[model samples]
Target: MPFQHPKETGYGHVIERYVTRKDSDHPRYLELGSRRVLRPGWPHAERFTRHLIDDAAAITDVELEALLAYEWRSRLTAAWLIGVDQRTSFRERIGDLLLASEVCYSGGGYCFALARLGTHADAEILTAYLDRYLPRTDLRYDQPEALGALLRLDAHLGTQHADRFTEPDGLWDQWVQALAHLQDSPDYTPAEQRRWTDLHCDFASGWARP
Candidate 1:
């Protein structure tokens, strides 16, 4: 699918009012913490990560739902909050956003949230995403993260939900092929490349990355 930036929010709409907002001068935790996670040697990254997790866990369900109803940044943070709190109530909404892929940069957050939810129903949502979107290799979207989440859940739950996709010439192959193009794109950067692998680790560990 082609990229489409979301349109509707008014110009100068205040983002700081959202629970996902960082201090007025600081970057959102997802943006800064993700970079720090990829480069663990960064000073104070671990401490910051701990704070981020605590803050996420503290967000109320009403605040979280409001975040989900906003743009990618808010949605991403909201998903992380739900995952951190194991708020299963938002599983369906997060799954719907993952499948919708309505906005950019939030799909990984949705996948991670589902992985943290850690239930058969969560696995079903991840599997449905893979079944529907993995065939479209042209769109990199969040297929890899979704697959990684499902596989991790399968390992922990002792199920084979990912077996069908991992077989030779299956969805896994499509995902790999998609990655090659993503890597080859001129806009791709080392940080961007590492982000995917970092997300895999985050999924496996339920966003507890250091």
Candidate 2:
């Protein structure tokens, strides 16, 4: 059989456990894929990218299922997880740290492994996260890697993708386009992982539009 769209598979139903935040007895679900990432003893966790790869693999054969299957955290985690999982380089591996960042917020991490793989283009995965879910108020997600990925993109591409951080304009359409040097990129303010700077709130609230 072919790889079915999630809508067609049994595992898709299992994945829907995360998607709908629902649970079942026979369908084998993590029920907490994102939460499982937070455990102190998560295997291979010393390596953030690998851990995400493992976590995502544990969920489904097709990584995109994890992308499609859930609460935004699992989805965002899936973004980083799949990004690193897909990298074909091994020379990039280094010591473990807070990529490890999303759930824990412990900070103090070395380089982002995905970025190290020279996959600045992979920011598209996280871009999907922002584009897909940022407008809603129901789900909560964490993306320490997102901020790191943006910086890595800046370094790699000589572009300054907007900051959903200290500046309201980083995520603004103008800079995201300038950074990609494309006619367009996903343009909007994301509420996740922000510390509520007045400028950030202004962008989110539409009080400060550019």
Model 2 scores a TM of 0.33
| lDDT tens per residue, model 2, 64-132 | 443334333434333333333443332122111222223332111112333434454444444444444
After TM-score superposition, the amount by which residue 193's alpha carbon in candidate 1 deviates from its true location, in angstroms, is 12
TM-scores of the models, in the order given? 0.74, 0.33
* Candidate 2, residue 67: lDDT: 39
lDDT of 1 by residue, 52-78 (tens): 677666666666665677778777766
- Candidate 2 residue pairs in clash (backbone atoms < 3 Å): 98-101, 162-170, 162-171, 163-170
The best candidate by lDDT is: 1
What is the C-alpha RMSD, rounded to one decimal, of candidate 2? 14.5
Report residue 58 deviation for candidate 1 (angstroms).
Answer: 2.2
- Off-target runs (Cα >4 Å) in candidate 1 are 1-14, 17-26, 29-35, 178-210
